[model samples]
Target: MTARRDELAAFLRAARERVRPEDVGLPALGRRRTPGLRRQEVAELAAVSIDWYVRLEQGRVGTPGSAVLDGIAAALLLSPAERVHLHLIARGEAPPQPHVPAPLSGSLRALLNGMPLLPAYVMDFRFDILACNAAASALFGPEFGHGRLSNTARMLFLEPEARETNLDWAAFSREMVGNLRVNQARHPDDPHLAELIAELRAASAEFAAWWDDQHVHERSRGTKRFRHATAGTLTVAYDMLAALDGSDQRLFVLTLADEPSERALRTLVTAHATALANAV
Candidate 1:
């Protein structure tokens, strides 16, 4: 009867309607008037009674326990983010409040500016590049420079140059999409993030496929390789540092993965600095 109940009911039904019987290793028993697995079939897969699932789907039941929700999530093949969302909604907890981005902390800026030798930047939960150092611009190219401040998710999946340069494109692309999925469920009302996600889904087939998989990543650290125009191959290990100020802003710091990469980064930054000074 309540809004939460209604939302939970809709979420469950939609999830159920997206999975085919064969998707869960069941046979295509016959053509039905509707799409997705039947209520009885889902109940079988989730180990719940048909009546119970019907009541839950119709928003006619009280808060179910964790086991029931988990079972239903698995039966529907929900992604990690969707699973968490199901629990929250079915348990009657309010969805997370929309995030209001805060200004970069002094320490985060200092970290970015001080790391002239390393490519560093600050990004919000939406993966929007908020601030970047000269080294980051130099390494990622001018698209990451001022005024552009492109979303990292957009670059890895949308930009042809990024796809060409990033040696671990497939792995990195999945991670970025997964991290964005977490935000998609967490902050459902963010227009900017919603626009970005829709854009990626419409424009990039890889993004569309990865998004449907529903993988969710809260934080990530990994080594990645890039084939730079001048530096041949550059490898870096990066970390996402959570801001200590209780904000969603994260400082991304990249370290050379090897001695050769370190030397190349130094050379790249020096040349970038010189070029900037010369144009002034």
Candidate 2:
């Protein structure tokens, strides 16, 4: 658990650097001492004693209560995922675990199979692609390649050709990165996720820049435009369906809302099925 103390310290440092004084409505006031917020300032904002907060940050104290952690999270302006991570760490509930990416079950695959008109896929908590239907394959393209498309966030940021295919590349990229940021905050000890981050940092400059923004976004309903080479412009609505077992897996489905896009979607769906059939 000594290692965990170091990890907690590192996380706190990273989180602190992410927040500028100006971000929290504090004036820059001519550069002076620290790189980020002072410890006392953080304590004041969290409504805790400086010594107690310092002890927590220093890792001298183990597993703070949820209420105290909540106060700290609020003061730090953590997103939902980050806040959860903080609580987990405070409770000593984090440790590296084996991450065997689960394949979508037969029933789930069948569900996706039945939704031939919609582009759909399943992803685990770490953003690993579990399964994608034929339409999803066509929509995301085969460069997602075959078999356990590891790390959707990495692919979106590091794959240059794939990034270009996205219509609103910048916005799409930011959202992807932001979601990963939230995930990292929540599960700092997840080795697979850490490896994904390291890989993206090594591979993509665009990812590196956006990652520094410290943005967080929850997966909710959203519209995305795709510039398909064969189908022209396609606009689709995305919905995230959570799993029942408290797992971090979600089924994401994309459906066309308008006539032109709907027609394009149909064509793409047929093309996708044909491609899949030929492969089989």
Candidate 3:
């Protein structure tokens, strides 16, 4: 519990440091000793007393009310996901127990196989790639080899190749970090998630910056752009399908919109399939 308190305090401090005084309408009066807004300043902005805020930051109290958490979130300029994480940590429910990895049943694989024109893949709650069709593999890159794969969020933040392939790297990076922020709130204690966060913080400055912002994003249909070395620029629509069972597995499918993009997609799929077939 003390450890959890300390962790929360550190997370709060990191979050605070990223937001400038000017960002929250505070006067940037000359130089400052601290990297971020002072405790009193935060208290003032949050409409709380210096003493109470100090106590919370010091981890003197076990839990804070939602109202108090809300104030702190506002003071820190936390994003929606970050606010949720703050509340979860305050209530000592940030970290969740690890569950067994759900298997990708044959039926699910069959369904993906049937979607010939669409690039499809299955992922666990942690974004671990369970299974992906040839089209999906082609969309990501040829470098993404088979077998036990790393989580998509981890790869996006840490892998140089993924960063290079992303058409709008900054936007995609923020979205990945924001999604991770939400996942952290939902399963804070997952060791895999913790490790991935630590690894990302070490690997990419951009990732570290976004992670500190405390942004959150819900899983939903969206458009993503990729710069395929062979296919040029390709835009695809993505959707997440939740598993019927109680497990947290989700199926992500990507499809092209028009003729040029569709042709590019077909080329990619054909190339990937040929490569895989030759390997087999």
Candidate 4:
């Protein structure tokens, strides 16, 4: 038991050491000989006292409750996998798995593809793009239509072009992170989700920091502006439609709010069709 507690302590220390002050929205102080975040800084962020955190690092504290563990995990900017590991070590039990996204139905695929004018797509709980319409394909471009690039969250953070295409890049990215956090809370044991989170954390410092904020969001509806390469600026309102079929999958439909945006979307769709015809 003591050995296990010691292992936990070491893990905590290592986790803390990997997160820098600026990563969590904290201003970088004077140069320190040590790397990563200081224990006091972590305590302050986690809303725990310096003494408790010190004892935790020293392996002198007992098993922390879920709330305290979650707070610490947030402060240390632990990934989903790391958070699950922390919970297991602290609670000595396996955590419950969140509902995994089921495969897209044929009807759903047909429905999404049928919408030629509107940019429509089906996304799973994790924001993986299962299928997209011609308009969506044209609007998002090739990067989003390919295999691994089909994941919207991954593309938003990892793809450099996404930063340029998204009008309000910072706000949009932060909201996406918040939505992912909501899913992470529900499905802590999901390996793919864990892997996705790890990749995002490694790829984007902004994602790493925003995730630590522990904001939760569910997508009902939102407005977005995009600068399509061929279409110029297009503003669209998106509605997330929940399927009545008991699955967690959602069909997202984007509609142009104004005449100019509608014209832009039409132009993109026409150009896309022309390119496809030329390719064939």
In order of appearance, the predictions have TM-scores of: 0.64, 0.62, 0.63, 0.68
- Report the Cα lDDT for candidate 2: 0.71
Tens-digit per-residue lDDT, 1-280, candidate 2: 7777777777777777777765554556777466877776566555467999889888887667554565566556677678667756667753335456555677787987788778888887777777777777777676453543455776677666657777778887778788877877776555556546644543466775676666788766788787888888888888989877656778889988689999987887788778778989
Q: Flag the better candidate by lDDT, 1 or 2.
A: 1
Strongest candidate by lDDT: 4
On a 0 to 100 scale, what is the lDDT of residue 34 in model 2?
62
lDDT tens per residue, model 4, 1-280:
7776877888988897788888876778899778898888877666567999898777677766565666677677788788788888766765555456778898999898889999998887778887888988888875565786888898889888888988978887898888887876766555466556655764578887887677777767888898877768888898989888977788989999889999988988999899999999
Each model's lDDT comes to 0.78, 0.71, 0.73, 0.79
Off by over 4 Å in 2: 1-95, 101-103, 142-150, 275-280
Q: What's the distance in Å from true for residue 199, model 4? A: 7.0
Clashing pairs for model 2 are 63-90, 142-145
lDDT of 4: 0.79
**Can you write out model 1's per-residue Cα lDDT over 1-280, one digit (the tens) per residue?**
4888888878877887899877776778877878898898777666567999999887777877655565576677778688678878887553344367998877778878998898999898788888999999888776684443477887777678888999999988888888887876666555456546655654577886787776887666889898998999988998988887767788889999999999998998998899999999
Error of 4 at 208 (Å): 6.9
Screening candidate 4 with a backbone cut-off below 3 angstroms (N, C-alpha, C), the clashing residue pairs are 98-187
Q: List ranges where model 4 is wrong by over 4 Å.
A: 11-56, 59-89, 94-99, 145-148, 157-160, 170-174, 188-217
| CA error at residue 143 for candidate 4, angstroms | 1.3
Provide the RMSD of all predictions against the true structure, rounded to 1 decimal. Answer: 8.7, 9.6, 9.0, 5.1
Clashes of each: 0, 2, 1, 1
Error of 1 at 173 (Å): 0.5
Predicted structure 4, TM vs. truth: 0.68
